[model samples]
Each structure stands twice: as structure tokens, then as C-alpha cells.
Target: MNQPLLEMQDVKISFTTSTGVVEAVRGVDLSIYPGQSVAIVGESGSGKSTTAMAILGLLPGTGRVTGGRILFEGQDITHFNDKQFEALRGNKIGLVPQDPMSNLNPVWRIGTQIDESLRANHVVKGSEHHHRVVELLEEAGLPDAERRAKQYPHEFSGGMRQRALIAMGLAARPKLLIADEPTSALDVTVQKTILDHLDTLTAELGNAVLFITHDLGLAAERAEHLIVMHRGRIVESGPSREVLRDPQHPYTRRLVTAAPSLASSRIRAAREAGLESAELVAATADGEKPQETVISVKNLCKEFDIRGQRGEKKVLKAVDDVSFDLHRGTTLALVGESGSGKSTVANMVLNLLEPTSGTIAYEGQDTSNLSRKQLFDLRRKMQVVFQNPYGSLDPMYSIFKCIEEPLALHRVGSRKEREQRVAELLDMVSMPRSAMRRYPNELSGGQRQRIAIARALALKPDVLVLDEAVSALDVLVQNQIIQLLAQLQRDLELSYLFITHDLAVVRQTADDIVVMKKGQVVEQGTSDEVFENPQQDYTKNLINSVPGLHIEIGTGENLGLAE
Candidate 1:
């Protein structure tokens, strides 16, 4: 075998925390050979990302390599100074960070950022920078590179911004690329496209890839070797399929069991195991659905007139003729890519945004013609929990205050009764009543989301609108949240209008699925009908875009792989 492009032998990384010294990566041994793709998968704080960051000497805060060595081409650079690391960064080891919004400078044009990287690394001459910038963006799957190069990051969408970051990362054609959670925030279709581009680019250039992600399906599908880390230690390492299909560690098994893929509905024989889609359709045929209708949207249409390039009025129809029905004590998922009108539909249902033309009825009452007093009273029965719990919540507000604010706004009860209700709400979400006094900043992402759910349920509403609720959470936390939602729906008899871009999550939480695209409904049916017999090409494409669906993992249901 040829020598490794990069190697880490018994690498021990640590950081100095407020409490004491903590080891983040403990004696992890890894290797990335030339022209090979390797992946390290684990949950947050499992040392996968820490090991990758250490390779480029980019550990944040007080983190340091406490023991062992990291060798590049047989050269020891474990203790390389900032100057040495800079020379190695863009020139040889390029990095594609997790969040493109924060990574790219908001003030500078996208082209300027890529050009700056090339200038710092001396990859292109000053005279050739413009042409090279366009070339890089074009290679990164962007269209009309010239016009895109002149635009700022804000002008681009989430997928476009990520592609720009990839273009910048590979501007110098580095021999070894470190992609850290590159597509975590992207839509499924967008994520698949970006990963495909990376594969082709790496293969053509004969470059090596070190992929760091929390997605086991991605690791198994994208890389040759898989390494699973847990609690700062390597728990499992082998061929991707071998490790994924038959995990030895308990944590690995839990992770495999928790992955919410579409295949779970039917591994071999069933949508809900013994509950077949055909049978489900038959049982509920001829208007046999017994559940009561809670919310009804008919011919929903929303349009925005925006100033175009030259200040001319341009009509952008965000939601066009969309319709769906939400039943009591059930879940209805609106699934699609980003900007596919899912959120717009949800906003319309929440009465946060009025439709240009259509009707939204709540419990057989038309919500569009509701007066001020009626609207104010109706708010107590419908509530929403937005995406990004960090931003949805106010930093200055304590958990108790955050939950109490809604009750206070509605004037539901006295001060003492509100306090008692807040306590009960926390208990429902499984959060400690003691944490009621704590602030949002002191909690983790999962904790914040739990608090957000509790706050959403504060008014004892019958309907819950969760817009990308669990998209920002880790895999384990996401599973927990899904389970919590299930329990809440069953216990409180709440109906959920869940809007998200991930169909994998839809398979887990949604009872009825509505697939949208380009402001139109592409497909709508029960979970079994959609997953078992998808009727549209777009819907089929979305199912195929799931990362590890094609793998041969015994039964498709248990391992959650699709044929």
C-alpha cells in the first residue's frame, strides 16, 4: 500500500474548561490514503469533529494536542506554529466548514472571498483572479458564474451559498480536503447534488477526502472506511458496510436503530410492518377516515410583488393553489426542498401571513373573515414553534418567563395559576421544573428545543405548527424529539402541522404526507401510500436522494435502507 496522505497516531486532544481540563479526542488513530475517501461519524461531543479540526490546527479556544503526533507525508507537524499552519492550510489542506452563512464574510462579495483565498495561498496571479473565480464557481455546479460572482452571500439561497463555500475551499486544488458537516443544513436534493459534485471533483483530481459527519447513512454511502467515535474514544472502525450493518458497540446500535429513514416503513413487506398501504387505503376508502377535521386549507394562494433587477414589479407566487386537511390527533407533514412553499403554507395556516386568495377554515369556521376580537380569541387554540430554537427564543428571557409570556398575553389565568401551569408544561416536555429559572444561553440545543415545545404548548392549544422543528438537532436528539412529539400528540390529543425539507424525518413523525415543489403540490397521501408507491418523478427522486438507501443491508426495514 502507498503511504498515507495524512496520519494520526494515538492523537490525544484536550481543552481547558471552566471546571477543569477535559479531553475531547483521546488517542484516536486514523489514516487517509491518497485518492481515498474516509469518514468519521459520531454525535456531538463524540470527538469526530475535534479530530478533524486538529488535523488543520484549527482547534478553537483553549484546545491543544496534549499527546501523540499528527504526520503529513511522513512529516511530524503536531506542534506547528501559526505561520507553518497557514502555509499548509489553503495550499495543501483545504477545509469546508459546517455553516456557510457564518463562514463566508457577509460584507464581501462571494468572488472576493474566493479570490482572497487564492491570493493568500498564491494559487493564481492577480491578473488571472477574475477568470479563476468564475471557473471555480462553475466547477462547483453554479449556473451563470459571472453574474453570481458579483453578488453577495445574502443574494444566494442556502444551497447556492454552500456551493460557493465549496468553490472557495477547492480553489487551490488541495491534495487533501476536509469537509466538516458540509451539507448538514441543506435540503436532501441539494445535499445529494453537492456530495455528487465533491465525488467527481475528488476522483478527477486524485485527491483524498476526510469526511467528518454525524450522519451514519452518509458515512456508509460516501466513504470506503468508517470510524465511529463515542465519548472521546474510537468505538468501532472497519469497512463502512461492515460497521454499519452489524455494529458491535451499544451506542452504534442505538444510532443505527434511531436513524429515521423512509425504508423503516417497509423493510421488506409492510409500510407500518403488518399495516400495508393497500390495506390502509382500502380500510379508509369511501370516506371511511373517522378522525375529525381540525384545520382545512382550500385553494391557498400567496403572491408577492417584489422589485426586480431594474426596480420593475415582479410577481413571485410563493404558494399557489395548495390544499390540505389536518385531522385531529394526527400529524400532517409538508415536505419539499427549501423555498418549495412548505413554510409559506405553514405561515398561512398559522395566520401569520395572509393569503392573496384562498380560504383557511378552523373547526368549520372561516379564519379569513375573522374580526379582531375573534382572531385574538382564536390564537389561544393555535400555536407555532419555529425553526432555530436559538433564534426563536429571546436570550434575555428565562425559561419560566418565556413560557409564561404567552399565557400572560392571552390572560388565561391569575399569576399563581400561570406559575402552576408553567411547572406543568415543563413536566410534560420532561424538562426539570428547577430549570424554569435558567436562561436559554445556559442550555444545550436539545434542551432549548424542549423548552420551545413546552412554550408552544403553554396555551393548551389543540393545534401545533412545527416548522423545521427537529432539522437543527443531532440524530439522537432528533429521535428523542420525534418520540416526544408522538407522546405529546397522543397524550394531549394535539394535531400537528409539521413542515420540513427532510423526508426521512417525515417517515418517522408524519401520518399524512404532502409533497410540494415550485409552489405546487406534487404528491399528497398517507405515509404508507407515499413511501410504498410514490407516483411522481420528483417524489421518487427525493426518496432516492436519501444518503444510504441503496446499500444492501439485509432487510431494508431494520437497517432503514431502500432498494
Candidate 2:
């Protein structure tokens, strides 16, 4: 192998807080050869990003490189001044940040932003800059390059925005690209395109990529080398295939085993276990009935008022003649990318937003024309768990109070009863009793989400709507949440309206699946039928776009683990 394009030796980064020094990266070693992709895999707060920041000389105000040697092209750059580092940025090294919305200036046009990046890197201005920006967009595989250049970042979709970021990074033709979760928020289709483009461009340019993400499958697909980070330390490092095929570290093995596709098998096994358990009891004869429909939507239509430069028009058809049914005591997943009307359908079902047309029947009761009072009553029958854990819960309230609010509001129980119920709910959701006193900020994302689920269940609702519930969590945490949801459904006979962009999650939790595109249901069927023999071209494309789909052994077995 050729000499590495970049190397970090015995690197250490720490933040000085009032409590003490917080070491974010400790004794880390990494190298990226030209044209090779290296993935730094870890959960949030695992020091992955901190290490990347140190490499880019973009660490937070409080963070300092306490000890390290950062070498680029065999040259030591530990003490490079701002001007020197600035010269390297975009020209020598480019960064694709985790949050595209946060990284791209909201006010700037996409083309202008790319132009500015090029200018900063001394890539020429005026016509030359414009031409380079267009070329970069083309290279990034963004369609309608000319029109997209004039559009603001807000106008672009999540995937398009991410592509624009990649275009910006490629504008100066940098030697190295540091991408932090580049495809994290994108749908499988867009993710595949972006990653494929990255792979192609990197190969053509002989440029190296320092990719960072928690998705082990993605790492396996796009990277050649792998580094596993945990609590500010590099726990493992090796060739990507070798690392994934035989992960020496326990954390890596756990992540591999926790993947959604793998979890689907576990779900299947659990279902079989339940069937066996039912057979064991003489009175519980093999009389288990097939699940029935819980919520059914027919010809659902929802149009959004698009306040555009032209004028206010109902041009955005958020949900267009969508039809689906949620089975009793089973999950019916609505899968799509952002703005595909999955969330809009969920909102309409919850009565948070009114649909322009169509009928929503809850256990055969038409819900389209429900009055405010009727809607309030309907709320008791159906509960919602939102995507963001922090945004869903009231930070001011304790965990116990948060969970109890729904029961108290519905007048289900007295204060004393509510408190006892909340404790029971927490226990049911696998939360610690001690957590009742903690605020939302005190809990982990997974823990906070468990509380949200408990609150959702407080009404004893027959149906639950979970919108991107586990998409925000890391693999292991997501697996746990998925398993918990399945177990809860079995125990309480709860039905789920699971809306997600994650195909893996859909496969795990959804018995039936609905694929939506441009506000319409393009396909609908059982998970097995859809996954095994997708009829619609869109559905087939979605299945094909799933990263590492061909590699079914999972990170655990691939990484070399034996249960």
C-alpha cells in the first residue's frame, strides 16, 4: 500500500470543565491512504467527531489538543496557524459536516455557497467559479444543476442539501474529504446515490475519505478501513472487511448484532416463541386469531398551503389519495423520505391536522368529521410518539410527572393513582424507578424515548403512532427499542402505525408495509411479500438502495463473532 495521505499518532483531545478535564479522544491512532475510505464508527458522544475536529483544526472553543501529532502528506501540522490551516481547508482538506442544515447557510443560494467555498480556496471567481460549481454539482449527481444553483439551501431536499455539501467540498478538488454522517438523514435511494458518487469521485481523484457514522452497515459498504471509537478511545482498528467480518471488540460485535435486519429475525423468533408458549398451556388452545384491521384510511388527501414567491397555493399535495390500514395488535409501517406525506398521514390520524379529503376509520368509526370534543375523545383511543426525545417531553417536568400528565389529563386516575401508575409504566418500559426524579436532559436519548413511549401508553390507547421513533438512536439502542415495542405490543395487544424512512426498522417492526412517494401510496403488502418480491418499481428501487443488503450475515458474524 502507498504511504498514507493523512495520519494521526497518539492523539489526545480534552475539554477543561469546572468539574475536571473531560478527555474526548485518548491515545488515538489513524491513517488514511489516498483513494481509500476509512470509517470512524461509534455512537453519539463517543469522541468520533472530536477526533475529526482535531484533524480539521476545528475543535470547540474549550477543546485543546493536549497531546498529538497530526501529519498531512508526511508534514507535521499540529501547530499550524489559522491562516496556514485556512489555506489547507477546502484546498487540501474538505469537511462534510453531520448536520447539513446547520452547515449550509440558510440564507445563501446553493450555487453562491459553492462559489464562495471555491473563492476561499483560490479556485477563481466570476464565470470560472460558476462553471466549477456547476461541474461540482454534476459530479455530486444532483439533477437540474442550473436550477438548483439559484435555489436556496431551504429549497433543496435533505438528500439534495447533502449532495450540495459534497459539491461544496469537491469545488476546490481537495485531496481529502472528512464526511460526518453524510447519509444519516437521507433515504436509502439518496444515500446510495451519494455514497456511490463519493466512491466514484474518490477513486477517480485518488482522494481519501475520513467517514464517520454510527451505521455499521454503511461503514461496511463505503469504507475500506475501519476505526471503532468508544469513550474517547480507539477500541479497534483494521481493514474494513476484516474489522466488520471479525470485530475483535465487544462494542463492535454488539453494534453488528443490533442491526435492524438482524433484529427482524429475532422478532420472527420471538413471535414463534409466543406461539410455542401459547401451546404449552392446556386452556390456551392453539386458537390464536390472525390480526384484524385497527385503523383504515381510504382515499386520503391532504394538501399543504405552499407560501411561495409566486403566491400562496395549495400546490404541495402532502398526502394524495393515500389508502392503508393498521392491523389490530400488529404494526403497519408507512415508509418514505422527508415530505413524502408519511408524517402528514400520521398527523391527520392524530387529528393534529385536518385532511382536505378522505376517510379515516378507527375500528370502523369514520374520523374525518370529528368535532373538537370528539377529537379529544379520539385522542384517548390513539396515542403518538414523536421522533425527537428532547422535543417530545416537557423538560420542566420530572420523568414521573411527564408520564403521569396524559393519564391525569384523561381523568384516568387520581394523583396518588397516577403516581403509582407512572412507576408501573416506567417498569413496563424497562426504565429504572430512580429515573422518575430526573428531567429530560438528565436521561440518554434511548431512556428519554422510553419515557415518551410510557407516556404514550398511559392512555391505554388501542393504537400507537410512532413517527421516526428509533431512527435517531444508535444501532444497539435502536434494537432495544424495537424489541421493547414488539414485546409491549404482545403484552398489551397494542397496534402500531409505524412511520419511518428506515427500511431495516420497517422490516423489523412492520408486519404490513406501505411505500409512499410524492404523497401517494405506490405499494402496499406484507413485509415478506414486499421485501421478497416487491411489485412496484419504486419499491424494488427502495429495496435495492438499502446499504449492505447483499451482506446478510450482519456486523456480528462478518466482524467475526460467535454467539
Candidate 3:
């Protein structure tokens, strides 16, 4: 390859804490050639983001490079001062951060934000700047670019906000673009569109990309080269296809096996790998009699009246006559893009939101007519796990307390018994006993999610309303959680109302699937039926939107593993 556009030789980073110094990034070596796309793949706290920060001189708190060098265009930049770094930041190296909502200022208009970046890089000025902003928005795939520019971040959807970020990142035509989990929270179709746009634009502009993410499948699909990181160290690195086909490290193998896209391809793989029970697999077989319904929804409708800018009332039909059934010991996934009413249906079923019209029956009892005491009793039979564990969990509470609180509130057992139950719940979720004393901030994303699951199970509910529960997790953690849910469903005879935009995950964990669009049910059927013979154009589009869908995986032989 030509001379590397960027190189890190034995780079080390550390942060000062009250206890002592924490070595976040150990000695590491990496290189990126001009116009090349490289991905650093790892789980949370694996130092992937830290290495990127080190390159951009944006490390948080007291973090600093303690050893080695970072060379850009054959020039040492490890010791560059902040003033010097600022000169090159937006002009030569641009960044698209993880969370668009948090990164973009809420008070600023979309056009103003992009204008700031363009101005900072001295790319455009005067009347020409406004036109430049519209051009950038258009290039980023936003429709009605001029109108969108005047809107605030809150007016745009998650995917649109991300596109704006991408436009800003590419505003200056930087030589290098660092995208940190840019599409981690987006729907599969939106993710594909954004990634495709980024790839095409970067390639055309001859800009190298340093992509950091926890998703091995996405990394393999998007980048030419892959570098696997584990505990602040490089575990493996090679051509993306070669590493995926024959992972040299055990960690890499785990990542490949855990990918949702690959895992969804064959349900038999779950049973054959012993991740689930044979009986559970048999229950879902094509010829088996239908299971009893646990929760039923009919003619569900939810509408909201909003005041427009001119003070005119507007009726928004968030959910329109949606209906579905959740069978005992089975998972029924509600899949759709953002604002498609998947979460609205989930909320109505959970009784957290009152429907404008319709009936929701739990065990043949109408939840709408349930008395206050009856509703309180119903809480014991149904529990929910949210998308963001960090937001759901109480930072002030320990893991033990978080789980025990539900048991205590329900008066399920004695104080001693509740303590014992908390321990058992931790074990059930595969969490360490030592973790019981730690706060939510002390745990990683996956660990916190496990704790959330443990807490949810403390009530021993018959049904779980999981709203995008595993969408934020890495492939390995997501796989583990999926297997745990399957086993629990079999052992406890629990039903799940799974809501998500990820059809890949829905295919693996859901027995039945419901596809929603613009507050309406576009398609609904068994997982096999929908995946194999999608009836709706929207359903086919969703299936086609899955990343790495066409990338073939080796049949165990390439990885030197037994089938």
C-alpha cells in the first residue's frame, strides 16, 4: 500500500483517578492508508474509543498519551499542542460521534450547526455558506434540504440527525474521517443507507475512514481491514474477510459465532450448538399444535392531538388498529422503523399507555377495565425491560438493591429470602456474585443489561415486554442474552412482547413477527413464513436492508472447528 495516511506505533494512554492511574490503552500498533477503510472491533470498555480519542487529542478527564507516537502523513503529532491540534482537527481530520442527540446542540438549528463546522474549517463564508449547508444536507441524503436546514435537531428523526452529522463530518473534505458507532442505534435500512452514503462519499473524496464499533458483523461488512481489540490490546488484525472466515483468536471466533445476522440464518444452529434446549426447538417446529395465547390485542388505536406552529390542532395517529397475540412460552416481535408505532403498541400492551380505542386482554381479562387493585396485582404477572439499561437503572442503587426493590415492593418473601432471591437472580442471568455491591456506573453496558434482566426476573413475571432490550449491545453480549431469554422461556414458560427495528434479531429470538409501518401493520406471521416468503414489499425491503446479508460465512471448516 502507499505511505500510510495515519500510523500509531506502540501507542499507550492512561487516565488519573482517585484510586490510582488507569491504563485504558496498552501498547498498540495500527495504520490507515489514504482512502482506506479500517474498523476497530471490540466490546464496551475494550479501549476502541480511547484509541480514537488519542488520535484526535480529545481524551476525557485527565487522560493523556503516556508512551509511543501517532504519526499523520509521516509527521509526528503525538505531542502536538491543543492550539496546533485545533488547526488540523476539522480541516484535515473530522469526527462523527456516537450519539447525535447529545453531540449536536439542541438549541441550534441544523443549518447553523453545519455552518459552524464549515466556518471553523474556512470552507465557505457569506451568502455562499447557506447554499453550502443545503448542498451538504442533500449530499447526506436528506430530502427537502433547505427546509430541513431550518429545523432543529429535535424535529429530525434519529436517522436524519445522523445524516446531518455525517454531512458535517465531510463538510471540509477532510483526509481522515473518524466515525464512532455512527449507526449503532439506527434501524437496519437506515443504517445501510447512511453507511452506503458514507462509503461512497469517502471513496470519491479519497478520505480514509477510521470506524470504531462493537459490532463485528458491521465492521466486516463495511471495512476492508479489521482490527480486533480486547482489554486494551490488539488480539488480531487482517483483511476483513480473511479474519472472519478463519479467526485466529478465540475472541474473534466468539464474535463471529455471536453475530445476529449469521446466527439468524439457521435456527438449527442454536439447537445444534446447545445454546437452547431440544424441547424448546421442537415446540417451534412447523407441525406442532398452536400454543395458548397469553396476551391479546384487538383493534388497538392511539392518537394524539398536537398544536401546530399556527395554533391549529393536528391529529396524529400513532397506532392504527394494530392487533397481535403473544403465545405462552413464545416471543412475538413488533418490528418497524422509528415512529412506526412499534413502541406505541408495546406500551399499550404493557398498560403503560392508555389506548384511544381498542381492547387488550391478558389471560382473557380486559386490562382497560381492570380496577386499581387489579392493575397492581397485574404488575406481578408482567414486567418490562427497556432499551437503555443506563437510563433504566438507578445510579444510586446497588445491583442487589435494584433487584431486591421489586421483591420488597410486592412483599414476595422475607428480607432474608429476598436477599437469597437476588443472588439466585444474578446467577440466572450469568452475572458474578461480586457484582451485587457495584453501582450501575461501575459496570459495562452488557453487565448493566444483565443486571437489568436479573432485576426484571425478580418479580417472576409470566410475561416480559422487552423494548429494544438487546439493540444497544455488542454481538457476543446480544447472543448471550438471546440464548438466556430462550432458555428462560422454556424453563419458566414465559411469553415475550419483543419490540425492535432490527429484523435480524427478531428472526433469531421471535417465534412470530409483526411488521409495522406508519402506525399500521404491514405484515404479520411466523418467523419462518415471513423470512422465507415475505408478502409485503416493505417486509422484503427490510430483509434486503440487513447488512452483511450476502456475505457468506465459512462452514466451520475454515475456522478449524467441528460442525
Candidate 4:
């Protein structure tokens, strides 16, 4: 109705490669009204970010806008040169990049980075610049803004660093803000706060927001309008609520059904439709007694003594008297925000870190009391899958070697047997045998994670400590991995201690859930009980913090079985 703030008509972007030119965005049409919030949602390589980059004239490498126009305030700037673009960037259109770690300069203090943006845009100067930096940090919700401004990016936590980035992005009070996966790495609660702050700030400043993300739930919940992209083309576009409530495109439907937040209802539908396999259903049949405990953690306490400003020792209770049980062939998820001791508990269970107090029992045997040889042997029964697949895997090693290394170290099988096992492991993870020779850098994020999973399974471990294993993956890839883990649990009768900040994912994969905060267990219950009726205020807040939690989709009885 009103004049659009930013508009893209038939925007085409391409990049020159060794082979030829590859089209990244194909005639995508999108618009964001003044002070409006719009989201572009898609999986990886779907051109969501590419379209955003085109608007900012910041496409990397050999990328160039080959056709169409990007109109800002009724002017077509498609052919704008770097000098012209510089005049608009930061002052007119600000960008909050996806990865804060890579986006922020490591050598600079948080205040210095924000000040540079302010100075570059000529927004403030000298004493006023220093004051502006603190104001920006405070606006971004950073605590003790003045003190925090002196700290480097490394000194801040993941959420804090993201807040610093947000402060920098909004430092100039641009007319439009393009936040690319701004909260992907943050916990759900922290994500909610950051997004809420961004929305409030943008609305107050009359700034339009073009939010690019792979999270369908987040997009649906946060944006007024939604554009679903697939293979460089728009498959669906409309009000976010309308598109999500009744998706017309097959791809959109897949995303909705695959989303872990919505998957719990889908599971109910699958059961009612008898679409799930009989074995899989029977493995988790109701009325059956709970399985025996595989790993039991009791009174787990981890404390770190650090020197304070006055050089006095201060005790930080990373994990305080936390307790939980992982049942045989069941998943137990530890849900909490960053610094909430979820990972600390996981590391303790894996024996990667020793607890200051408490006991970790494996099949009734105290892990701390085990002899060196016994502990070494115990590693064969318990394994871990870390958060970052790329970081977990060695770039120098082939996929086959990565998987085979574990078996070789444990002396589990002969040379030929290990080779055969490697192939089988890859197949189990739905990877082809041909991928064996490829290095980590050659694979996609999902493929690399599968390789990591294969490596974890190589030892034939009965238990797995999956610490945010699928947190970094796209929704589709995350769904696939969740399904794979479900199947593996059924087939191998494996128990899992899943540690993550994603409650949406936990609802889908975890049978039992543990809610932790400040190194303490706030609540614990079955997934159904916890999700449907949370007992603790903290748990309620966590569930409420999940984006799209308010959208009530029809059940199997109403919408029929999901395909």
C-alpha cells in the first residue's frame, strides 16, 4: 500500500567459476515496506543470503549482478559502483553478518569496532563518539555497557558477541537492516531477547528489516511477510502466518513438516496413519516399562576458581549438584542457555572434564574409580559427537581414515574388517562409499556431520554424548539426522545424552528432558509432560522463547496425516 523502502524486481546474480558461470539468484522478486519486517527463508545454497548480498552489493568472490534491478527508495541502484555503494552502506543499509566470530575484528575492542562504524558514517565524533559506543552497547542489551566496551570480541560470550555485532549494525541508524541468521548460534531464550531488542530498535527508528534465515519457525514468528526460496527461485510468498498455516508449495510443506518444533505433532500423525515402521513404533510402545539406566549422574558439581579484579579467588559453580539418568535405548536431553552448565555436564559424562564433586556411573560402576586400563576400555562403550562437524573432523584426513582411526585405535577389528566396517558405517549414515576419499573441506555441512557421526559410531559405543551435534545444520539436514539417530537407537539400542540449547529439536529427539540453569536442574520430565505442561518458571520461559511457539497447527485428526 505504502511506498516500499527496498524492492528487488527480477534480481539475477551469478558467479564465474572454473567451469562456467553459475546462477545464484534467478529473477527473485521481493519487497520490504518502510519500517516493515520481512523474512527470506530457505535451506543452504537456496539463494536467500545471495539475494540479501545483491541488495547490499556485497556478493563475495566472482559474484556479480547480471540482470534486473535493486530499488532503494524508488531508485534503481543495480549498476552502482563500489564508490557509489560506499556512500549508501552503513548510512542507508546496514548488514549484520551470519557469523559474529568471522565478522568482528578479533584484534579490536568492542567499543573500537562500534566507534569505527560511527566514525565511518560520520554519526559522531571524539567525546560524543565514546558516549555513543556505550549507548549502542546498552541499546543492544549488553550488561555493564561501559565496562563491556573495553573488552575484545573474544572476551564476550557467543550471545554477547552477537549483541556487540547488533550494536555495530545499528550504530548508524540506517534506513534498513539486513540481519543474516543473526541468532542462529544463540540459545532460544537469548535469541528471543536479541531479536526482540532488534525489532524494538528498528521499529523505533522506522527502519525496515530484511531477515535472512534457514529457520522456518523463526521466520514465521518474527516477520510480517515471508518469502520462501528454493534453488534460486521464490516458491511461495505471502503473510508469514498464512503461508505457514496452509503452505501451497511442496518445498514449504516439507520445511514445515521437517521442522523439529512441528515434528512432535507429525510423529503423532505418523503413528495414527500407520506410516511409521512397526519395529520403530514397537521400540517405543506405550505401556512398556522403562529401560534400565545406562549412565547415571549423581550430585554432579563442577567449580572453577578464578582470580577476580582484586586478585581474590572466586568460585564459579559451572555445574551444581546436577543429576539425571540416560536410559538404555532412549535419549535424554539437557536444555539450557549458554553458560547454563549443559555442556559442562556433558563433558563430565564423557570424562573430558573431571567434576569437582559427584559421581558418573556406567552400568553401576563409578567412572572416577575405574583404573587406567578400565577407563581406556570404557571409552569404547561411550563416545561423543561435538557441535561443529568441520572443527571435529581433521581437514588432512580422508573420510574413510577419520572413521577408521577409531577402530584402529581400539584394535576392534583386523585391517580388512576395519575397511569393511568403514564402508558399513558410511552406508548407515546414508553416505556413499565414494565419499571415503574426500576430505572435510570437500563436503557440505550436512555431509561433514554425517562423517562425524560415522566416526562416532565406529567404536560401536553403547552411549553417545551428542553436544549440539545438529544445532548448526539446516532444518532439513537436522530432520534427516534426527531420523537417522532414531533409527540407530532402535537398531543398535544406543543411549544418548543430548546437550543443546534448541528446545524445538529436543522435543523431537529426546524422550526425557532435563531443564538446567546456573548449574542446577530446574526441572526434569518426559518430553510430552515437559512440553505440554512445564512446571517451572524457567522451563516455561524457555518454551515460550521458542519462535513460532504460538502458532497452533492442526493435528492429524484435523489436518490428516502429513506426508
- Model 2 worst lDDT window (10 residues): 277-286
Single out the weakest 10-residue window by summed lDDT for candidate 1: 279-288
lDDT score, candidate 4, position 25: 89
The lDDT per prediction is 0.86, 0.83, 0.88, 0.87
Question: How do the residues 1-563 of candidate 2 rate in per-residue lDDT, one tens digit apiece?
Answer: 47888989999999999999998899999888888899998988899999988877889979988997999999998888888889888899999887786789999899999989987888775668778888889889888898789999888887889899989888778899999888887888888888998898898988899998888778877898889899999998887767756767888777766766444433344444563332112111123535687888999999867777567554788899999888787788899877788999999988888889999999898987778798899999899999888789998999888998888788987888898898899999999889989999999999989999999999889999998999778887887898799788888989989988889778666778899998999999888678877998889888777766555443323534333
lDDT of 3 by residue, 163-188 (tens): 99999999999999999998988999
Q: What is the lDDT of candidate 1?
A: 0.86
What's the C-alpha lDDT at position 494 in model 3? 86
RMSD (Cα, Å) of model 2: 4.2
lDDT string for model 1 (396-511, tens) is 99999999999999898999999999999999999999998999999988899999999999988999999999988878888788889888887888999999988877876778
Q: Considering TM-score, which of the candidate structures 1 and 2 is the better prediction for this target?
A: 1
Top candidate, metric TM-score = 4
Better of 1 and 4 by lDDT: 4
Off by over 4 Å in 2: 261-289, 305-314, 552-563
Task: List clashing residue pairs in candidate 3.
Answer: none
In TM-score terms, candidate 3 sits at 0.94
